[model samples]
Structures are given as C-alpha cells and as structure tokens.
Target: MIRIAGLGLVAVLLAACSGQTETGGTAQAVGAAGPTGTATVPGVPAATVAFEGGDQLSPKDPIVVRASGGTLQAVTVTNPQTGNAVKGALSPDKTTWTSNDRLRYGATYQAVATAVNPAGAASEQRGEVRTIKPSGVATASLFQPSSGDFGVGLVLGLKFDHDITDKATVEKSFKVTSSPAQDGGWYWVGKREVHYRPKEYWKAGSTVKLETTTFGMPIGGGVYGGQDVSATYKVHDSWIAKADGKTHQMKAFHNGQLVKTAPISMGKTVDTPPRGPTPTFNGTHTVLSKVDHTIMDSCSYGVCEGDPGYYKAPENWDVRISNDGEYLHENLKTVGVQGSDNVSNGCLNMNTENAKWFFDNFNAGDVVEVTNSGGPQLSINNGHGDWAISWSAWQAGSALRG
Candidate 1:
C-alpha cells in the first residue's frame, strides 16, 4: 500500500480538485485515495538538483554546486577528454557541494552533480566551460653593425617582431661582455628597438660580444615565439689622431703609444663664422659623433648670411674629432694645406678618417696626438673626454652625463 505524506497528499488533492468530472465518469482521484480508495500515480522522488551559482567558469578559479529538498549522494567534476576528476560530498542539509581544483589555462572542463530523495530515486545536472592561456613572446631580431665591425661607436640595436608583455624578461635575455671590461647599460628606444652603449665609448683594443636568448618568452597575453642568437666583434687598435690648425698636421696614436703622424688642413680663419669658431690647437680627442650624410653650409659658420654656398656632402667620410665643429674628414680638394699652416673654419680636414684607418680603429676615448697648433687645445664639448680632460675634470662631467 502507498502512503502519502501530509505535504504529498495536499499536492495530489489540489491537482484532483482542479479537474471537472463527466456524468458517467467517477470523481477525480484526491489525496492518498483515488477513485478506488488508493492513489493511481506512484510517488515521485523528492530530489531537486541545481548549480548554486550560474554555469560559468574562470580558467584558473574554482566552481560551486548545490542541491536542495533531497539527500545529495555524490558530486563530481571532470575533464572529459583528459579524464581528470574531482570528487566532493554534499552538506548534511543537502543544500550545497563544492569542488576544489584550479581550472587549467586554455582548457575545457565538465561537472556533474547527483542527489537522491528518501525514496532512493536519483537526479542529475551537468555543466561545461573553456579556459585560455595567457599571451607571450613570439620572436626577436638583432640588427646593426652586422657581426664583425668593431670600435667604440658601434651601437648594439635590437628589433622585436612582436610587442613584449614582460619587458624585464625580454631585456634580461640580451647579454653583453667586453674584454678589457668596461661598464655600460642598455637604453630602450621604442617598443621594438633597444640600444646599448658603453658608459663611455669602448676602450680601444677591447673585445665585445652580444647575445640574444629570447627563445620562449611569454611576451604578452596569449602569444609566444623565437630563438637564440649571438655575435662577437673585436676592437682592433686605438687610432686616435691629433690635428693642429696652426701646424696643419695630424698625429695618430695607438694603445697610448705614438704611431704615424700625417699632415692635415684645418678650417681657414675666414671660414670661422657665427656658429662659433672651432678650436685652433691640437690635443688628444676622441671621436664623439659620426654622420653618414649632412649639409655643409658656409652660412652655418657665419661665412655668408643668406644663400651661402650649400654642399650636400657625403658625411659618411666625416668623423667628429672634437666637441666644436672640428671633424677629421676626407678632403680630396685640400691636399696642399695638409702639412702647412692652413686653417679651416674649424674642421680638421683629413685625407680620410677611413682611409687613414682612423675610422676602422679609433674609439671614443683613444688618444689623438695633436701638437704644434698656434692656439690652446680644442675645448671638450661634443664627446666624453677620456684622457683629454684630467681625471678630476672627467669626474665632474660624470654627474652631468648621468
């Protein structure tokens, strides 16, 4: 015999009373007794299952479940393909169940919860969600001074193919080593490019190595790529050359020792214009800056005002040997004034910084042996003075450079 509980009988009676009876048909069944003094339908298990929270999941977070008005029997969450499973028990009140496991990045997971009522019948509910990985490194490329060129001004530059998420990690991958070691640091120019220069120019005759090891860096949210690279170059010799305007000669030095001395023409006195007069004397000067192409104008030096003769010059051959407008450059035209007293506006005219091997070896601080100029030594303004300025003077400049 079927026995209906107080609440169950009320529910059945309400359903039966809602229906109308026909003339020949018996009265609709009600309560624990139907038309024949017994309930026609069997009892329905009282289980009710549901997820406490909405069916959504985060990649690396946890999920919760709940069941009510029943006895919760089991709770299981699993990754179908991977067969990874997590099992938990429901609270005694049959209200909730919770699984403890961090969801995997870039993965999908499934969960199923079950419960039974006092009658021993069961009910179930299921859910699914997907997770994604964070972005990261794709690739990198190193450029400039391609592998074998040497000297102080050889700037190490790197370009990246993808934007990096972790700049420090990517930067740490770049490594530098110098023989006859000197201290230096890397400065970032932009999103993809970075430049490395010694605190001063490289010491003459020093060896340098550059390496990039950005192989599998997580450069951003959900991306990754690239490989390792390395390049090495040698500093051949110190080719510091001194140019005297009055004497019209350039003396070269190597490794703090005297080498060949060559005749050079300097800017003429009339050439000194408004920009500022280049120094007249010669001394140890380092190559501070170099340009491949530039416009040379007499008006820039105050030679002529408007429409002064403009020369689209090949600056590649020009080497800025001093802070002022002075440069050690090739002057195929002024070969006659090289050995004798013939001044330029301020530039030191060389046959060729490259041809003289000056470009090939001289660095920012190597000594340039200048003597015999009519005036005082050229003032230090453009580049860092190595031995050109006294140690005390150099220390003073350090604060400014920083």
Candidate 2:
C-alpha cells in the first residue's frame, strides 16, 4: 500500500458486487457466488476502483483502478472542469492503473476503466472522485538566469510568493538535473528565498534543468503548493576575469586560455567612517547584468552631489559585478592613468576599447575575481556572491543537511 502524507484519509476496502453484469441493456451472468459470497467467475472480466472511504479525495491521493479475472483494455481519468486527462501508467501485466501526475486542488475527476475477458466479452466501470479544497496555496518561481545561455558560475535562485515554513518538504519537491549529472544542493537564504549551486562551477556547454512537482504538495500551516514550476538554462564557454589591484591590470581567460590583458584603474582609498572606504571589494564576484550605456553617479552609492570626489557622468559598456556599485565601465578621463593609478570611486575604470571588448565577450553568470583591493570581502547577500562562501560552509546552509 502507498502511504499518503498528511491527506487525512482513512483506508477502506472496495468490493465488487456479485451478480449479472449488464452493459448497453444486455445482461450476462457472472460466475456463481462462492462460500464467501463473492463472485468467482472464470474467463469473466471484473473491474474495481480503489480509494479510501468518502467521496472527497485529497489532491495528494492517487487514483487507482484495478482489473481482476481478465486483462485491462484501457483506463482514463479526466478532469471535466479543465477538459484535461490525468496522466497515469498501467502495470506491465495490465493488472493495475495508477496515476503518475499531481492533481489539481478543488477539482473533480472522472475515472473510466475497460477490460476484456478471455471469452471476448467487454465490461466497463466508471467512478468519480473530487479533490479536497486547500485552505491556502503557496507559489514559487525562478528569478535568475531567465531562460538563456549563461556563464558556468550561475546559481539557480527561487523565490516564493509567500513565506514557506516547511523548508525540507518544499526543498525535497524540487527535481534538478543536468545533461551530465553534477552534484549540487539547495541552500535556503531565508523563509522566502532559496539558491542552488553545484559543488563546482557548471561544466561548460552543460544544460541544466530544474522542476518542482509542488502542485498539491502539502506545505506547512494548512497550505498546499499552488502549482508546479520549471526552468531550463544552458552554460556557455567559461569566461573569467581576474583583476589584480596591486598590478592595476585585469586578465581575461576563456576556457582556461589567457585571451586579453588590459590595464584598469580600481577604486582609490578614500576612507569615510561608517560608510567606509571607496576601495573595491576583494572576492570572486559573479556578473549580474550589463548596460550598453548608462549614467554613472557616485551619489547613488554613498558620495553625495556636493561631497568631495563626487561626479556623475555618462558611462558606456557598463557591466555590473556587485550590488555595492562596483562595475567595469569606460571612463575616458582615467584612460591615461589606468595601468599606473587607482583613482575612481569603487568601479573599475577601463578604456573604451577594452571595456567594449569585455562587454561583448562576457555575459551574466561569469566570474570576476578581485585581489589586493584592501577592502572587506564581499558578502553572500551582495548580488551574486554565492562563490564567496566556502564549499563546506555552503553545504551547511542546506535545510536537508544533518
């Protein structure tokens, strides 16, 4: 027997009546009754619907139809409201039919079964079951890598419409697979958000898929999963840029081959208590997004309009690497001093030619490692800073971890 989880259902046996079976106004005598008063007919088909007691069924409960005394011809369960048939599978010997897909809540389904006896007689059985209405439904959706090719450093991010108290059950409902299987796990950032990442960066040219069969799943506090959701994304070639603050240069690598090395001006050391210095953060930062042309304003971060060393100017080829207002963008004024000095606020100042080339080569999910910046390490909560955490520490964030 299959165990039903939190469905509040009581198991009961369903018995078929013994007597003449009629179909289309034609009556045929079934096998005579035995000592137990149950019909035992040879070469006669018998069909029965299996369910727990009561007319109302939980969406988590599976609809099952079994055949006896003959081979089953076909079985179908349809939702009249949506005009969609429930997906299910039949046993190898044609003895049982079991639903394979999740059912909709607060919906009614009609089950029909047809069987044939060895003597070439056919019989049909029909039944109806209604799914119980959920008190509330919880919804979730993927917010990162929105269906496109990205760099290998991508981490799948899922955000819930509401708070989910039952993290383990909700996490277990997800099915994440890759073209070549890679080990990965989900880490809950909070009650409403979760992130998934592989043990290492995704292999180049790998296709990853994430799906959750949350429909009808019991979430905590009498809430069920609203519906199922899924996403598919592909990983392009590995593109990583390493910026050395000490050398004032950034090196670009593609598929482990050094492609381009360009001079860059990092954030200058201008310490202001509370808000801290303007030095660039030192860590492995994932590329979040890119803008072809945008206005770079120092006041947007911390420097004010009238404050010293404050400036707002139109920038080009801006690629945002952190939420802390750090980016790789073109700044013509810093071009002459690019390789020799650190003069900008917090962004990496690059020449127009090199900045445009970097923008054309790298997309989202790419990594940019910064070193010798003399600033605080990036936090995991800052933009795509998933790589900031160590492997063992990252695994410890999982709710399923012991």
Candidate 3:
C-alpha cells in the first residue's frame, strides 16, 4: 500500500494479494515517473525546480531559484567541502529564493530546494554550480596615512595591484565612516589609484576609518579580488597656511586661529631661461612630506646642471607641497627682500627663523593656500590637490553619483 498527503486528506493505493505471483515468485512494486527523472507514488504531483545561471556561474553574479506547480518550501545553498552556506533571501510568495552574498571564485556550491504543492505534496531537487575561475587576482592597499594622526586636510589614498576596469564594482565594496561624521566621496586618480576626501576639510579631532571587503570581488579583465583591507586614522588640529603673493607674507593658522605671520619671498614673475616660468602655482595644496634638511636642485624641475636657472644647494626646514618641485623652505639669500620682493624659483622662500617655526608647527596633510601667485591653479593630479576642486565637481567624479 502507498499513501499520499493532500489538503487535510490522505489517499491510499493498495495492490491486491501482491505477496506472490501465480508461479510463487516475489512481485515487483512500481510507481509513476516524476518530473525530476525519478519515481513517485501514483496520485502525487512533482514540483519543478529551476536554477539561474545553471552550471557555469560568474563569481560576481547572484544565484536565484524558482519553483513551478508548487510553492517553495525551503532552499539552501552551501559549499560541500567547507560546509559554508550562502546567505539568501526568500520571496514572500515562497516561489523564489535569491542569494544575498557573492559566490567564490572557482568554487562549487550545492543547492537544495524543496517545494510543496497545493495538495500538501512536497518534492525536492538538488543541483551544483561552479563559479568561473579567473586568470588573475587583484588586491589593494592603503597608500597614505598608515593608522596614525593626520591633519584635517588629509586625503585617503588607495592603490590597486592591477588597473581596475570595473571601478563601480570595486568602489561599492569600500566603506568609509567617521566618529564626528563629515560628508565625503572618492575620486579616481587613474585606473590604478583612488582618493577620498571630504566636501570640506575634515572636522578637527575626528576619527576616520576606511575599509573594503574585496575578496571574491570581480575587478574586470578576468581578475578577481584576493583579500580585504582596512585602515583607521585620527584627524589632528586644522593647520592652514595662507600665502599672499602681493603682500609677500604667509599667515599660519591652527584650528581657525591665526598663530603666526612671517615675511616670505614667492616665485619671481620673470620666466627663467631653460626652466620657463618661475611663478608658484595658485590654489590649495596639501603637504605631502617634510624634510628637516635636504638639497634643493633645479634639475629636479627639468633645469639641468648647465641650464641658466640651474642651482644646487642645501635647504633647511623643507615642507613639500607639490609634485612639481614646490616647497616652503628657509632661504637666507633673499632675507633682505623677503617681505618686499618675490624672487625665488617657484618656492615660498622664508627667513630662517620663520621657516623653522613653520616646520615645527605644520605636518604632512596640512593645507597651504596661495593667492595672487600669478600662475595657473594647481592641477588635481599634482600632490594632494583634491581640495582645489569644488564640492559639486568632486562629487561628480564618483562612479555611483546620482
């Protein structure tokens, strides 16, 4: 006898005297065929199961399961070897189940789904899916401010191991948060690098953190992500130096309060031979590095040893503000004309006393705004020039921008 369940009812199909055949041999029991190529008892209907992406699946895509002739009862996807189950969400109608997490690269997953018919009959189906293996893997690292204190103007930088073609997919994995929260967004410097900065300078004394769960992330060009990355840093007091080319003076401020004023000699207006113009770039600049004593050379800026404007000499208290060979350093040769004349070569030349003071107070990630410098605004590609862009324009750079 075989029994099947229905809506609060049970139907039994029994064979008459099936213990033996007329020849005294044992009789075989047979049933009807089910949709899954299996045998099912008579009067019971089999539920249909469908798996999205069938066999070869992309690691970046999600898995979906659907049922027909019945409502889905239960569904689970798991990695057989590791016994790790994929997270999924079931539709309210109980007809669909969708994966919530991304699949792993070159990994196999097993899906088991059960569906129940209106008559209360249940049927189950199991299937296997394997994510495509990529040719290469990509990773990322924090390129600036390694878990320490930085000025409010600090821009978080990240460098990717490979050129990421699917930037939106990669960017979506990143998470940035702060204690004293401020609005910020990311800007791609190039295919291999990205930077994050607030609409305005970060609030002083705020704590900022950057993280990305890139493992299993598809980075385009058959490249998958490897490991996750994260970094946390504290924002120090806001240190700003405002330089006025017309007045030949630089005013230093700490946390919105003016701290010091010093006479400085900016770039000369005349174009130096072999080196072209000597005017300093005008706009906001973020400090990249600080050197107590270093040799200053014109060759670094393309003015070679035999060039007319070429010179090599030691300088003290140098704070680098741009990749185009610009610094705030002590220059005793122009001390007499520091307040009256702009006679240096694209640098803010200050007296020894004032230069020492600036070096002691300012740090990397500090800000320097130059005005009336008689030069073009600094390009966003030079140093940490993120602040030079307007807030609206900066937000437009995001791949997910509305």
Top model number, lDDT: 3
lDDT of 2 by residue, 328-377 (tens): 99999999989988877778999999999999998999989999987779
**Model 2: which ten-residue window has the lowest total lDDT?**
1-10
Residue 271 of model 1: what lDDT? 42
Candidate 1: tens digits of C-alpha lDDT, residues 231-324: 7877665555656555666666565576667777665544444434344445555566565445565555555644434334444356676555
Model 2's lDDT to the true fold?
0.78
Pitting candidate 1 against candidate 2, the one with the higher lDDT is 2
| TM-score on alpha carbons, each prediction | 0.41, 0.74, 0.69
In candidate 3 the C-alpha lDDT for residue 73 amounts to: 83
- Estimate every model's Cα lDDT from 0 to 1: 0.54, 0.78, 0.80
- For model 2, the superposed segments whose C-alpha errors exceed 4 Å read 1-62, 65-102, 110-127, 179-181, 272-276, 297-311
**Candidate 1, position 148, lDDT:** 66
Tens digit of lDDT per residue, candidate 3, span 129-247?
77778888787888784698888888897888888888898889989999898899998888888889998899999999999877776678878876678899998999999999999
Model 2 lDDT, residue 365, Cα: 92
User: Lowest summed lDDT over 10 consecutive residues: which window, candidate 1?
Assistant: 12-21
Q: Per-residue lDDT for 41 in model 3?
A: 41
